[model samples]
Target chain A: MTAAAPTDRTRLRRAHERGHHDRATIDAILDATPQCAVGYTIDGAPYVTPTLHWREGDHVYWHGSSASRALRACDRAEVCLTVSILDGFVLARSGFHHSVNSRSVMLFGTAFKVTDPAEKEARLTAFIDGLFPGRTGMLRPNTEQEIKSTTILGLEIAETSAKVRSGPPKDDEEDYELPIWAGVIPVAMQAGDPIRDTRNRDGVELPAHLRGWRWPG
Target chain B: MTAAAPTDRTRLRRAHERGHHDRATIDAILDATPQCAVGYTIDGAPYVTPTLHWREGDHVYWHGSSASRALRACDRAEVCLTVSILDGFVLARSGFHHSVNSRSVMLFGTAFKVTDPAEKEARLTAFIDGLFPGRTGMLRPNTEQEIKSTTILGLEIAETSAKVRSGPPKDDEEDYELPIWAGVIPVAMQAGDPIRDTRNRDGVELPAHLRGWRWPG
Candidate 1:
């Protein structure tokens, strides 16, 4: 497991035990979640926008409208990408110890635009195929105009960390004697039955990917 | 509906139609979700952290460990708080129209620490009772020490906006004839059966609040 070097920005000041700097742990987190929050600053104020993210090897990519102020600012500034999966809520006897069990990743790097058209197309196809193994061939190819209107940014896995907490709550020794129910109430992002579009083409079958979609198993 | 004044910071450069400046819309979105992402800057770099959030009247509050570097920096800096609910995935015939059906709220303001002990305690209790209805009475009250170890930051909804999109995908007139399955796959965050702690006291029954907890309904 190759680990990212601890820079001043990536160091964990609190809960250092739960922090991991290895790429193996970071990749596990990025692969499990499709959504992420991007942090960037404009005129010294910070903004976080939620969007879809995908990974390939040691790179992470996300796209937004070409006119997005956050995206345009981030392309030229330092940014942070964070992805989180809330596993469960930990109920403890003491309010101090009550917390959530989760897996999360934080990465800091400069985001640069993917200017090459060929590279952009490959990444776009990977975004679809990664979620649906063989659905790329079934859809119409993206037009040149459509590609021009979108902005894609890529960041290397240069400085990153993963924090994971699982299992029951850790209450103080004295608090355990209280007659209070304490345990974990597991939470999940569950996919429900698909709602076919009212305008779906006739005789179109439900693709295997959309029928059984899930994240962070 | 009270609307937030549009400063350059709160303006929507892209997807202008989806942006809403009304307080009625912003509060409704904030009241429905339990979590939010906070964006703050340190040494000119931006970081986004995910944590639980609660709203009271015109103010929003989030708590963190007193030792957290992000919270310490945010108490003095300008911050952005964003909440998002991923309702469904929009699958269109052409990739350009593909999007997600979601309701999100973003607020830009300065966060200040709640230094008064009494106000902090009351807000803490409100956080629990807000979700569990009547469950606060069943648990032991918090001690002074537990309160001191936590840091609570409050931000007013002075400059805010709510963005929402729902319904089926909007396919192009020419691409509607393509033989591709297109529609929304409804997504939700759901609670499963609560797992009793291995150290739960004997004879403790699963509380009604825990048994039927739902979000942003």
Candidate 2:
């Protein structure tokens, strides 16, 4: 794992001291979650579109409809893309001090639409392969016309920050005397039993990697 | 449940038919998730801030630091607030068609700051209690000094819409015959064992509600 690059953009809040800035920390949070809320503005009105995103090094990639207004505005324009995962509920003695454990990343940069045909295909393949791993090899590739109709946007990790809050909540000393339940409820995302497509031909065995997929903690 | 108010802004997506417009659907999705990525523009740059949010009837409220630049710009400005829950992973025969079962609500409205002290306190209490039912009554109320240091912003549900994708993935009829694995992996957030605060005073019984608190599905 690469050490987090020191920059003002990556500062964590005092309450978010558990938040990690290292490359591995950022990648872990991003990889565990597949969707991101892409935020951009059009004519001064803010818009957030939830889309599937895959990470490649410091860059994040997402595709939208050819006619998406938000995508058009994001092309070469500054955008904010955020991914957040709720880890658990934090029950605290004090109401004002209650909080949740979460991992979130906010990247501030300009997005450039990927236009090269071959590059687009590779990135799209990378996107699918990142989520499904070896399964990408078994699928048909994208056609030129299909690739032409999709718009892929990439945002370089220039000024990025990750804020995380973990462990149990801290309560005021006086509030601790109050009878209240307090603890952290751990949340997780796990893979379930594979469902074979009804129309799948006679006997293709499930890939080894996909059969028992488990995300590293 | 109130019928979805018909408006151009609240209309469901044409391409996605399962998206719902009922108020119960919107509120349930919003209430189940406690955090939202608030998108706004400051000095022509886009910023997305993750903050805890709560819904009251058709209005949604969120708060941030009194000194937050993003909060200041968003107050009184048209903003987009989005809350999303990733329910499951959707595996399809085609890579391009792979998706996730998700519930998302997008609100387009102007946000206004709560200036009245009494109203602000009430709203803040409601926000906290909404996340942890019955916890507010057990804790100390916010003082004038504390209230003055927080900024609360509210967005009405005048122009809002929700989109949901559930059940199995929709693969192309032709691709269904491909030799592949396909199905949904259900994801959820659950509670864990409570950790007693080290500073807690002796003999304080845990509140009954907190001990068995479970998020409504």
Candidate 3:
């Protein structure tokens, strides 16, 4: 899938070498984690709210309570949505060169509210079933009131750039001779055993979607 | 240590019950992970940049290349810094109730550039040693040019709030009786074995800091 080219807003100013404009790189980083922070302006002041996000085709979506002021402010307004994953710690011989290995994608665009009730419901269902496929069909259908109380927002994949840093620290040639231990301490997100709710009905065994679930690090 | 009260911006408008104003709650969420996204405006457009951050006393600090335009825009400007950790996935009987367990803190304040060279150096050292403890002392000291080429910015924790959601899914009473599975799949950040720099001189064993280092989450 072709991605939008880097715009002035998405261009990397500092470490331009780490910037990637391809859709493959951007989508991988976006799909690796459901965690994302959406930054938008409310009354000309910047507010960043961390929320769960998912991607469908070329658009990324996030949702909140319909009454959310943050969501209201984002509708038809410019927004910056970022998805990041900490890869590892890059320990170097000097403090200036010390850094963390990470993968991140920063998308710049206008966020519009998913106004159509049917589209909103379908997108919300995709969000849930995206993580645990087939589970959404098994659950009780969402009521009209439930759908009305939620708001989903989406942004196209234009004006986006992905920055990634990995491998050992890059230190000054002279500093490499120092005795300091320099390398990478790899970090990743992992899932522990599932904890069943006490109210769960008997004979409802763990489903296949979650039994084989693994965090995409 | 006491924290600042939630201002008009820091207060949780959606889930007021999940809001926490105490310093312990805010600091733990800040310290658990170094990953942070700094949101600030450039010519009325919001930009969120992911970077490593460390807290000292009641202030949070992050640094970047001296030539960074993002850092320049943030200096002494209204900015929002957020740190978040994804805890688990809350699967419920209905799509509306599906959620993720997470801890996040959003801090709003003006970020000031650390101009004092000595203080900047000390804070940079603290950023490194904050994770590995004593390893900063073992590394070659940062040179004057290195210090001159970095920009360190800090923001006081005067208006901040921590939002946390954990445990099993909270579904409607009638939905809970459905056969769909409901539970929480706990998630955490884990560190793998350290990889030594290929350029290391012979006999430089893994230091105690890296050997015992573990992600706080």
Highest lDDT model number: 3
Question: What are the per-residue Cα lDDT tens digits for candidate 1 across A1-217?
Answer: 5887888877887888888888988999899878788999888789999888999999999997788777898896799999888888888776668789988999899999998887887888888778767667777788997788888999999888889999898988887777788888788787788889877867898998776777545
Residue pairs clashing, model 2: A185-B192
For model 1, residues B1-217, the per-residue Cα lDDT tens digits are 5786888877776678888888888888898877788999988789999888999999999998888888898996799999988888888887778788999988899999998888988888888778767656776677887788789999998988778899898888888889998888788888777888878778887888787666544
lDDT by residue (A1-217, candidate 3, tens digit) is: 7867678888877778899989999999999999898999987888888888999999999998989988898899999999989989988888878888999999999998898999988998788878888888888888899899999999999889999998899999987788777899999999999999889999999999899689965
lDDT of 2 by residue, B39-137 (tens): 888776777877778888878999877877668889998788998877777777766677778889888889999999899889988886776667778
The per-candidate count of clashes, in order, stands at 0, 1, 0
Name the runs in model 3 displaced over 4 angstroms.
none
In the order shown, the candidates' DockQ scores are 0.80, 0.54, 0.83
Q: A139, model 1: CA deviation in Å?
A: 1.0
Question: How much TM-score does chain B earn in each model?
Answer: 0.95, 0.91, 0.97
List the lowest-lDDT window of 10 residues for candidate 3 chain A. A1-10
How well is each residue in B5-31 modelled by candidate 3, as lDDT tens digits?
A: 678888777788888989999998999
How close is every model to the real structure, measured as TM-score?
0.97, 0.89, 0.98
| Cα lDDT tens digits for candidate 2, A50-147 | 88788888788999667766688899988999988777777676655667788888887889999998998888888877766776778755567778
- Measured by TM-score, the strongest candidate is 3
